[model samples]
Target chain A: MRYTSFTSYDLILLAQGLGVSVALFLVTTLIGFLIGTIWAVMRFYRVPLLTPLITFLAELLKNSPVLVQLFLVFFGLPALLKINVTPVEAAVITLSGNTAAFIYVIAVAAIESIGRDQIESARVFGLSRWQILRHVVAPQAMAFAIGPLTGLLVNQLQVTSLISVIGVVDLTKIGNILNLRTLKPFIVWTVVGGLYYIAAKLIALGGARLERRLRAHTAWKGL
Target chain B: MILAPHVPFLLKGALLTAEACALALFGSLVIGLLVAALRTSSSPLLSRAAFIYVDLFRNIPFIVQLFFFFYGLPEIGIYIDAFTTGVLALSIAGGAFSSDVIRSGILAIDTGILEAAEVSGLSKPTIFRKIVMPIALRTSIRPLGSVFINLVLTSSILSTITLNELTGSAKIVASDTFRPFEVYAVLLIVYASLTYLISLAIGALHRRLNRDRMPDVA
Candidate 1:
């Protein structure tokens, strides 16, 4: 007896798969956010030798393929360093670093968008560097950064799909399993791609909302 | 220690990676130029068709598209090797992106300049050839560099279809060498450094190309 029909359980599998992808995405994004902010600050302060080094590191991470980064972490690092790296761990590290690199660039640009006069004024007002960053730079920079940040997040969402290759059992991997079992690329891939598409759209929508809120202070109040 | 012996094999893989990226870059540029022209054309139908192609390719995951072509192609009469398939897929995807850059480049051309050429009695083909393309290309050289960098990064996905480019080669070395972490770390650094150098060169080129056109900010 051949069982070629689509099973009802595949829905559950897809949901579970998407859960893994989203969970990993959120976790890494948070980690990446923090690390990327730090990298940006490194540049902002002109930390002597460290600034160029961070810039170089970010460039390297930004330019190279995530797949190579994944392999390096997942397959290469374990063998060379003689340490165990879970697939999820590898995915998190690689994706976070990659995300951070892009964010670092955006943050630096956002910070720079705040003209020197504004920074100098803040400096004159007896604001500490930390206070200036928090009270002066961060607010304005966030507004400046949000537009490009939305684009980056959208691209990063697509990038999360690559983690499936490292055996993270993410949505893409689930689709692979279902596709082979059901032998229906049309049904399987369409469903998988639809889920991804919806998720991407949702992120974009959320980003738009966040950007609006961030930019609210800068909205014109009319003369 | 284990991977020390695989240097020769890895070098061979690097060569394959270079070859694939080189071919794919040329293929993408040709495809990009044609699509860019279509996008900017006066014909609404052609422009709409080009827009749909770009949107479809950009929205779909590369792996899904790759699998569709890899599995779906055999169902049809077409049969191509993995290397060829990889290059073809890269070209299509890269073209979609490259076209966007080129289209903007085309749009950025001065209407005044075009008018001058037209008033000179230059044909459409000659105007596009001698006047528009050179200027658009010179201004866009930097954006095009990023697209190519993304293409290089995307090439790693080609490995899943059984094409052992640089990342593919490193995969074998990792398992055989019994140092997955170290091997991958090194590979990551190598790729990063390679692209850094490429962008540095692009920056230099952009500065040179736009040196005389300072006010325009090419």
Candidate 2:
């Protein structure tokens, strides 16, 4: 007889999948944030050739589908470079690059949202460029970027589902396995989608909380 | 060198992609219009229902939704080919996004103009169809363009469901030539340039449509 019925071990399998998805999401977001910010900083300094190059790379990443990127990395890279790349490694690289591209855009916009006058005044005040960035630009940009960053993070979490196609044993992959075994796509996908939905909501909630904290100083205060 | 022979095959896939995107775009615009209308309607229940749809579709990953429809539809006795299912899925997902854009466009309509329409004795549906939609769509052309661009990129995922569009056909070329790198790298550039051209066209269209209200609308 086919073991078509859902069992307790299935819960453990799902939890494992969820763990992988969440862990990968967190790690990639952190790496992407760092890489993307550095790219924005390069642009801010107007690094001669690098700024344009970074811009081109960001646009390429932004316009193309993540699936193609994943395929290029997972399937194409090993063959081209003659290197061994585990699925998880390929996923990490692809997702981090994708996330960084988006973050770079958001970071640049947040920086531009700061007025030129503020930077000029900081310069007039004998503030160093670094100080001007840290004291004047970073704080406000953080506040400005948090909203978009939150939206990006939620979207990135969903993008993680694409990695399942690359055989990452992510929540979607687990759902796929269960689906084929049980032949019940509705129950399998709903549960899987629901888990993703909850995770996205949590990211959104965290982002909102962070945004409120970042914007606290700007909130109106009683005289 | 190896990819040259496969150019026609890839072009065929591009043609399919173009056809699917065109049909899906039309389907999405209609669904978006209706959803946006419901979302902005006076009835709380209608608006709430629309809101839930937009929220659910927007939050959930598109692949999951695609899979749900791909697998679930057959179970419910709705037998459709992969192309049909793919287009239907894209339309629904694209509708959620386009609806959001159109709804905002609707929301941005000046109250004075709406009041004037009311005073002119136009019926609600007439005011909506004649006055509201044109202004909203014109104003929202740029955002709608982005939504459609996203739809194009998202179309690549249809390959997973076995539709063999541009990305899918590229997959075949990759395996056939054992040159996954060249095939996908070229595919990436093609997609990026294609989207870039689309955005350029959208910008021109936006400028031409809103020419009368130039500087303010853009």
Candidate 3:
């Protein structure tokens, strides 16, 4: 007998899917953040050959669809390198690289948003380059960067859904499974879309909170 | 080297992609204009309804939205092909984004001009069409271009629903040639260059249309 009804166990299945999605998003984001920042710093220091190369790579990644990039890593890389890549591993690598490319663009912009006069004055204060960056640029740039970073994070969360196309059993994939099993696309997809919507809202909320905290130093306190 | 034989097949797919994006772009512009008008209208209820539409569509993933229409429409007995469904989904999603752009453009209009039009005794629709829209659209050409470019990139997702657009055709070639790397790598560069050319064209169009304005504005 084909049991096509929605069972209570499906709730647990959804929660597990959500957990997988959230975990992957957080891990990839952290990795992307570090790699992106390093690339930005290399540009800042004018590392001779790598800066232009990094810029081109970031531009290429940003311009292309994330789905294609996922395919490249998941299918293309394994076929080319003659190695097996599990779906989850492919999702992680692709998402992280894509995220890093975007973050690098934001970081470069945030760093450039700092005025040259401030840096020159800091130099005259006899502070070393690293010290100037640490004390002077970092705080201001963080405040500037948070707004765009928040937007990027929310977008990256949605981009994570594409990994489902490649067979990772994340929330979307779970939705796909339920969608087929129950043959109820409306109910199944609505529930799945609702989960993603809530997650995106939560990330936006967290980003706003962080932005406020970062800008606290600039907020006026009335006497 | 291996991709040369498949070039004609891939071009056919790219033609389909171009057709879908072109139709969707026109559809989106119309929807965007209407939504922007509604959002900017004096009626609070209409604006609120429009706002909810934009918010819901924007917050949800495009693929989710696509599937909602793709699958749900069939259930409701609408019975459209994947191509029609993909275009409809793309237009709706693109409308949400372009509406935001157009709404901002509308908001940026100078109050003096509206007041002058009011004093000239033009009807509301006439005033909006004659004065507001032209100015808003011209100023926002650059942003609208980016949104269209995004629509192009997002068109690749239509492959999932069995529509053999550019990305879909590339997938077939990949499996057939057993060279997923070359196929996808070339596909990626093709997409990047296509968008780059579009951006350049948009820049020229913006400059041409806005030439009468201040130099900085152009």
Q: What is the C-alpha RMSD of each candidate to the true structure, in Å?
A: 2.6, 1.1, 1.1
What clash pairs does model 3 have?
none
How do the residues B122-198 of candidate 2 rate in per-residue lDDT, one tens digit apiece? 99999999999999999999999999999999999999899999999999999999999999999999999999999
DockQ of each: 0.53, 0.85, 0.83
- Tens digits of per-residue lDDT for model 3 on A1-223? 3679999999999999999999999999999999999999899889999999999999999999999999999999999999999999999999999999999999999999999999999999999989988899888988999999988998898889899999999998898889889999999999988998899899999999999999998899777
**Alpha carbon deviation, residue A122, candidate 3 (Å):** 0.8
Interface RMSD values, listed in order for every candidate: 2.0, 0.6, 0.7
Over the true interface, candidate 3 deviates by an RMSD, in Å, of: 0.7
Highest lDDT: give the candidate number.
2
lDDT of 1 at A67: 85
Model 2, A194-220: lDDT tens digits are 999999999999999999999999998
State each candidate's chain A TM-score: 0.97, 0.98, 0.97
CA lDDT, every model vs. true structure: 0.86, 0.95, 0.94
- Which whole-number lDDT from 0 to 100 does residue B130 have in model 3? 94
Q: Candidate 1 at residue A73, lDDT? A: 77
Per-candidate TM-scores read 0.91, 0.98, 0.98
